[model samples]
Target: MREVAFITQNKEKWLNFEQAIFHRRFKDPDELATLYIHIINDLSYAQTYYPKSRVIAYLNQLAAKAFQSIYRTRRQDTNRLLYFFRTEVPLTVYQHRRYFAYAFTLFFIFVAIGVVSAAHDDTFVRLILGDGYVNMTLDNIKNGDPVAVYKSGSNWGSFIGITLNNIYVSMRAFVYGIFGGLGTGWILLQNGIMLGAFQYMFHAEGVLWESVRGIWIHGAMEIFSIVVTGAAGFILGAGILFPKTYSRKTSFKMAFKDGIRILLSTIPFFIAAGFLEGFVTRYAGVMPDMAALIIILGTLGFISYYYLIYPFIIHRKTVNSL
Candidate 1:
């Protein structure tokens, strides 16, 4: 069937299913389960025949919602927390993939801006990274240990401090969405610029590779989590900016629900990043090149797959199994 015809045929049923799930006044677990089966059947058909159509994604969202509602009416046979992390977060992240794209795009663009600006203006690095940090790093470079900053604090103290600071940064990235996402964008811009300038400073001092080996040991997870948090912020902002078919208040509430879930998913990642920064990144300069490379790629690959790739896998598997 043509995509348009398929959507036209099932669209009303999908909308009704959505309404039935959203309104608590009319919830019936058994009845919703019946409707959910129908929705999944349609979703599987859409997946097989209309694989490229947006309808697949739309149906997937409905299927997820319906499944949540149906489960709400029943006792859990499985661990709810495991199900939430393993399934729910991935599905919701898939639905908001565009926000991820937007956040990363803005961050990279600003990073480029920082690189270019700093390359031409020596003072730009000082301005973004602060004079004290610039001076300290320069001194460390002279001492033949550019990453010595990470070694200054005790490992346990650094891990605790870094983890707390990471959480604070992520919360700000998420909470700023109330201003319509621009605040989150600003945070991304600032961080991106600082990163770019900081790296360029190393390059100018003939230690680009030296810096990468140590910095990326933990920088991989730390930076990726921030970008993901920024996406969550965008999700929050999107609700306020585009309240289609729902009141502004209702839309904001829905956005907050999903946004917070996205934020919650990053907690473990932030902790991992902090541990690496405190205990590992400091030794990047002296550690074996192969070992440092593994840590960097391993952390980067793990988080990237979770947020960027795993969602489709779970969503597709859930739809097809039904």
Candidate 2:
């Protein structure tokens, strides 16, 4: 097709992709994949037909972004891979995938510092959780109701309340990125450190295994959502930091919109996690070990298939059909 003919024919598609990537919700994985193809085609066409055009160069950069999204979604395959992707790689991408090595290096260094400090100091968890919470938890444990905090209400009521609250927290974290991304960074740091400290507290009490079996039934998905929310915040903050071709204001707006959409996508995950925490975790004392194991394994299995296995299957099927 002639350059203009292709441009004219794809004008709608181009606009759709542009809006989806820069404006629409990020949850519709299919739209994201479709946009990837459109962007790749547009950039290749521009290079072939209008190499010197500034417009072509700009679109090419956006196309690169589309490709990176594909890579991010693609890596979320196996449970092991999904664990890494959901927890680690997405955060790195938030900082710019190009800097993943540096970001991870710094992350591990900080984690090590946290681990070492906690190892030496019995008071580290207190510092992280605060004396009030430690005392409250100790009081609960002494009363023969270690996890009573989660068992205080009707299961369904707690489920709805907690789910809604978690979603709001995640959305706020993303929206707060308007404060020049510091808000997002602070949220991530505080949560990450608290998680580590929480785990350490259980370990110190010689209940780490019990804690993992009981808590991760819900914590796995809930915590993953938190990380993804952080990614959304990063997306918003990134626009402000590196506007690249567009005016800073325009880039910031685009990023903020996308970030909100990313946060919106986590609603269902939060709901499910909340249900498990409220109903299931609260009854861990009476629930079968096999049931909790199944729940944890099943959730991880779903994440593995949707993110990692499905993509490879699609790619291979397409190759074979061709």
Candidate 3:
């Protein structure tokens, strides 16, 4: 493109970025960094395509200003934790919202497959859930407490163990993106299938409502975190599979950073799930039906709103402000 055309095309965006920096309109450091990257790319193009033009010098000056704005040290905010949850995570989620959709679609499809297979084959639940688990659950059902397995351990011990296990699972889902997301998909498939078969087993035994009331208190958060981690894996994998405007190395580095943040965001939810499972799920058999429903639905609603709805709300506000 001609120098004039290039300048005309990007001038408005550059001006907006300048206003964002000078007026302090950016939502967070991440947004500033993103703008800086764009500025750097524009500067590179100017140098390469219009080296002798005044636009090159102008872009260099603009890029330098943006760099300083982004990297300059400022007093650390005391409310860093609040800022992260309120701004950083939601912005990142908004940016990669489609990956969340992809993860959910893949998981649901696997769940459907599991449900169909289990319905067709009597041994399917055992295969998916493992013979030992199926047998133990069968014994529990015979003894009149199908979910009694949750009551096996001390509450605090179970909480710690389950929380640690969930963290490990999420990390695996994230790190396995090094395999370009197949590993993460495998993890999701395994979990989704097990969930489907397990639910089917309870339904076949005529205790679907009982099982849901007992399991979903914690399962809501746990399952949602799993799906989010799957999305994180896909974000990482996409860095390799589809680098778009960036080099593969650059894309992967960016993806890894964002993926880490996304994975970290799930820790609290996992802990909450652990607490519910360790304490609440054990009493699910005795808990009032209405109370159980409230817990399950409330947890589900919180996860859905935070991960799915809040991001879009933040995005819209940010865009409108810009």
Instruction: Give the per-residue lDDT of model 2 (tens digit) for 48-158.
Output: 888876657567556645544544455545676444434333332332432223323333444455566677798997898889988887786667555656778899998
Error of 2 at 141 (Å): 4.4
The sequence of per-residue lDDT tens digits that candidate 3 reaches over residues 23-47 is 6788886787678678778888988
User: Candidate 1, residues 1-322: lDDT per residue as tens digits?
Assistant: 8878988898798878778877743546667777778888898998899788777766766666654455446535478788778777887888788999999999999899999999999899999988999999999999999888989889989999999999999999999989999999989998999999999999999998889999999999999999999999999999999876568998899889989999999999999999999888877777999999899899999999999999989667654544
Q: For this target, which candidate reaches the highest TM-score against the unseen true structure?
A: 1
Better of 1 and 2 by lDDT: 1
Residue 117 CA error for candidate 1 (Å)? 1.1
Estimate every model's Cα lDDT from 0 to 1.
Answer: 0.86, 0.66, 0.84
Q: Which model scores highest in lDDT?
A: 1
RMSD of each: 3.7, 9.2, 7.4
Query: TM-score of the candidate numbered 3?
Result: 0.80
Model 3, which residues run further than 4 Å from truth? 1-77
Clashes of each: 0, 3, 0
Pick the winner on TM-score between candidates 2 and 3: 3
TM-score for all predictions?
0.86, 0.66, 0.80
Candidate 1 residue spans exceeding 4 A from truth: 1-15, 24-64, 67-77
Clashes of 2: 3
